[model samples]
Target: MTTKLPTLPSLQIPFNQPFATGKEFDYIRQAISNGHLSGNGAFTKKCQAWLEAEIGCHKALITHSCTAALEMAALLADIQPGDEIIMPSYTFVSTANAFVLRGGIPVFVDIRPDTFNLDESQIEAAITPKTKAIVPVHYAGVGCEMERIMEIAENYNLFVIEDAAQGVMSTYNSRPLGSIGHLGAVSFHETKNVISGEGGALLINQPDLMERAEIIWEKGTNRSQFFRGQIDKYTWVDVGSSYLPSEINAAFLWAQLEAAETITRKRLALWKQYHQGLIELEKQGKIRCPIIPQHCHHNAHMYYIILPDLESRTTLIKKLKTNNINSVFHYVPLHSSPAGQKYGRVSGNLTVTDDLSSRLLRLPMYPSLMSEQIELIMNTISQFLSSQ
Candidate 1:
C-alpha cells in the first residue's frame, strides 16, 4: 500500500497586501484636477494638517519615505561626525542609516525580550560625552518605555528621535507613539497599517525645531515661509535635501487617514483572533506569541510567533510556503550585518536581539485577511508544531 501525502491548499496568501479605502481614486482624480501636482500642494497640506490635529504634534511634515523623515530628523538633531546615536540592533537599517548619513555612529543596545524594544535599563551605561541622541524604534507598533527614555535623555541632554514606522494609530501610555519624543517619524509604506504606497511624516514635538524642520523638508530653503508670506524670498539657508513626496501620494494618504480608526479596529480584531487561537500552542512551549504590555495599545501592524530555534522557524516557514501560505521573518540584527559592523558599535550583550531575530516568524497580517484564512493559518501552524 502507498502512503498518500497531505494535500496542500490551492489558495495563496501573501505576508502583506496593500489595502485601499475606496476613496483613493476619487482623491487622486481631485489632485489631478487641481493642476498642482507638486510637493506641498493642497493635498499635501491636508495630510500634514490632519497629522498635526490627530497626533497632536506641534508640526508635521510629510516626506517621500520614512527614510526621508529620519534623515530630516537627523539634520534637525544636528548630528555631527562621530556622534553616537543609541538604538536597538533589532531594527531596519534605516534607523541607523539616517544617522550614519550625517557621519553619526549607531550605538547598538539589547532589546527587551517582551516588547522587542530598546531595553531602557541598558541605556545609561551606553551614554558617553559623544552620545547625541537615543532612537527608540517602536517595533511592531509597540512603544518603547518612553517615560524612562525621556528621563534619561533629559539627564544626559540627548535628543530622542522615535522611529515609529509601524506605529500608525498605536498608542503608548495614552500618548500617540510618534508624538511623545522630541522628534518622531511614521511611515505610510505599503507594508504599514496606513499607507500611501510610499509615504511618511515627521512629527516635531519641540516648538524650537519646527522652523529648521520645515527648512530641511524643503531642501534646505525657507520656501515654506516664503509661501506663507513670512519671507520676501526663499533661499538655501541650511544643510538639507529633497524629502517631500508629490501631491498624488498625499491625496491617497488623506483617504487612509480619514478611515484610520475603522482600519485599526478591524486589524485589531484579526490580531485578537490569532492570539486567542494560538494560546494552547504558546502554553505548550511549542511557540511564543507576541507580548503586548499593559500600557500599550498596538495597531496590530504584525502578528509574529517565536519558534524554539532557527531550524524550526525555517522548517515551519517552508511548510507554510508549500501549502501556499507565505510566512516571513523580521530583521537581522544590525550589529551582525556588514554595514553595521563598519559604522556602528555594540553597547551591551545582544543575546536577546540575536535569538529573537533568528527565531521570530511573522504570519500573514492585513486588514482584509479573512477570519477563515486566520483559522487555516492557525490550524496549519498548530498541526506542524504537533508533529514536531
Candidate 2:
C-alpha cells in the first residue's frame, strides 16, 4: 500500500514522509508487465539477493512486515509454551508479541541509559532454565553491545534473534546489525530508513536454519525448493503462516535497495546537522542528544532529544505543533502496559527504561527534510528553554 501525501499545513512538517527513488514507479510498472504479482516473483528474488549480499547473511527471505519476520523467527527458534525470551522493555509490542503468540513468556529487561539499547551486563543474570533466546533490539539504528551479547548467548547455548527493525545499513564492530544474530528481522515500514510501505526481511546467519526459514516464509510449504527442481511437489510441511509480501512491494523495495548507500549518506548528513544545531542546548544541560558509540556505525534512522522531564517534553511538543512542526514521543515501558503485565514478567528494576522513555521526544527526521526547518526547530527549542 502507498502512503498518502501531506495535506494540511501541520502535515507539511510531518514526523515522517515516505521516501521514493526515481525508479520505484518504473520497477512497479515492470512488475505488472512481468505478469506475476504474487510473492517470490522476480522482483522479490532480486530484493532478497540484494539483502544477502549487502547484509552478508546466509539467506534472506522477504516477509509482509517486520512483525511477520519476527514471528517466523519464533517458529524457527522452536519456542515452546513456557519458554522465556529475554528482551528490553523499551521496544515495539511486536518484539514481545511474536514470542507470546507461541506461548513464550517475555522476560522484560531494562535498557542502557546512554544508547537506550538492551544492556548486555544485565543479560546473564536474567538467564534461567527456561530461557530460550536473547532478542536485542537496535534502537534508533544504533548497534547494541553485540560482542558481549553474543558471548553471553554462546556460553548459555541460547539463540540470538536480532530485532533490527530500525537498523538497516547500520553496523556494530564493523559487522551489520541483523547479520550478527542467529536470525534477524528488518523492517521496511514507512517509518523506517528503507521503506516498502509495509514489508520486512528475515536474515538467516546459521546455515542449518536457512532451508527451514524459506519454508516458513512460504507458508510452511516447500515451494521454493520445488521451483528449484530440488523436489517434484510442494505441500504444507510445518507450522507456519503466510508471511511473504506481494511482488509490488518487493519491486518498490528493490529500487530503494539500489540506492541504499545514497539514502544513508543523506540521512547521516541530516543527523549531523541536527546534532550540531543542538550542541549549545545540550551543553547548557537543557537537553541530551543521542549518543553513538565509537565502535558502531549507524544509518541515522532517527534523531531525537531528551528533555529533563516528561513535563518539559510535553511542553516542547505542544509548542512545536503550534508552529506547524510535528514532534512525537516513543514507546511506553512494556512492563508497565496491561498486555505486558498479563503475558510477561520483569527481570529487574526498569529505572532507566521508565526515565528515558518519558523524556525522549523524536523530531522531524527524513531524507527530504530541509536544513532551514532544522534551524527553526533548534531555535524554537532554545527559545522555549530560555523562557523557562
Candidate 3:
C-alpha cells in the first residue's frame, strides 16, 4: 500500500479580496458598447443616483481615489496653512496626508485599545485655537463615537470630515457613516468589498457646500454644470484638481453597486463564520478577535486577530506560510513613520498603537471564503499555537 500525503494549502492568502457579482460584466459591456468613456457619463450618473438613494448622503461625487476625495474635503473646508486637523495615528497615511497637502497641521491622537478608533475622551484636551477640523476615521469598518465626536465639534466650532474609506454601507445607530460628517471619503480600491481598480467618492452632507464641492472636483472648473447644460461653457473658476473618475470606472463600480446588497450579505455571512469559528481559540488565550461596538453595523471589511506578542505573532505567521496560508498585517502608527515625522506633529506616546501593531494579523477574508476554508484556517492557527 502506498502512503498518502496531506493536501497542500496555499501559503499566501491575500489580506483583502474583492467580489464581482454578475452585474459587473453587464455594466462593463454596456459602458464599452455605449462609447462614452469620459467622466460624468450616463453610468456615472447612474452610480451617483444609486449611491445618493442608498447611502442617504446629500450628494455623492465619484472621484479618482480616496486620497483625492480627502483632498477635496480639505479644500472645501478651506484648510489654510497651520490649520490643525486632529485624527488617530493608527490609520492609513492618506488620512493625515490629505490635510498635510492643504498645509493643514495633522494632530495625531491615540486610539482606544478595544475599538481601535480615536479615543473620544482624549480629543478635547488636544484642541487649541488653531484647530480647524476633526477627522474621525472609521477604522476596519467599525464606527467611531460619532455622536460624541460631533457634539465636541459643534461645541468647539470645528469641521468634521469622516474618513469612511472602509465603512461604506456600514452604519451607526441606523444612520450611514459618511453622511454624519460635513464631508466624507470612501474607497473602491481592488482590496475593498466592491472595486473599480482605483476609485473613491466624496460625500457632501451640507447642501450649502454642494456647488463648491462640485467645482473643486472638476479641477476648479465648472465642467459639471457644463455637462449638465447649466452652463454654456465650463471655465476655470477656482483652485482644484482632476478629482473625477472615468466613466468606465464608474460603470465598473455601478456593476458592483447594483448587486451591493447581495455582496454585503455574502461577506457578512463569512465574517460571522470566522467570528464564531475562532471564538474558542480566543477564549483559550491563544488570540483575540474584533469586537463590534453597540452602535456599529460593520461591513466585515477585515477580520483580524491579536496574538500573544510579537514573537508569537511572527511564529504563527511563519507557520501559516508553511501551510501556504497568506495572512497579513497593516498600518504601523503614522506618527512614528518617517513621512509622518516630517509633516504632522505627534501628540502623546502611542502606546496602544505600538502594542497592537506587533500582535495583530489580518486573516484571509472574501465573499468566496467558504465554510470549509474557514475551518481549515482556524484549525491551522490552532494547530500552530498548540505546537508551541
Candidate number achieving the greatest TM-score relative to the actual structure = 2
Higher-lDDT candidate of 1 and 3: 1
Off by over 4 Å in 2: 1-9
- What residue pairs are clashing in model 1? none
Q: Model 3 over residues 94-156: C-alpha lDDT tens digits?
A: 999899998988999888898799988889988999999999999888999999999999999
Candidate 1 on 1-388: residue-level lDDT in tens? 1111123245478788788888888989999999989899998999999999988999999999999999999999999999999999999999999999999999999999999999999999999999999999999999999999999999999999999999988889989999999999999998999999999999999999999999888889999999999989999998888999999999999989988998899899999999999999999999999999999989999999999999999999999988789999999899999999999999979999998899999999988888999999999999899999
lDDT of 1: 0.93
Comparison by TM-score, 1 against 3, better one: 1
lDDT of 2 by residue, 1-388 (tens): 3333454454658888778877888999999999999999999999999999999999999999999999999999999999999999999999999999999999999999999999999998899999999999999999999999999999999999999999999999899999999999999998999889999999999999998988888888899899999999999998778898999999999989988998899899999999998988899999999999999899999999999999999999999988888999999989999999999999979999999999999999988888998888888989999988
User: How well does candidate 2 score on lDDT at residue 13?
Assistant: 82
What shift in Å separates residue 199 of candidate 3 from its native position after superposition?
0.7
Superior by TM-score: candidate 1 or candidate 2:
2
Q: For candidate 3, what is the total of clashing residue pairs?
A: 5
Whole-model lDDT, candidate 2? 0.93
Instruction: Give model 3's TM-score versus the native structure.
Output: 0.95
Candidate 1 clash total?
Answer: 0
For model 3, the stretches where C-alpha displacement exceeds 4 angstroms are 1-12
The best-first sequence of candidates by TM-score reads 2, 1, 3
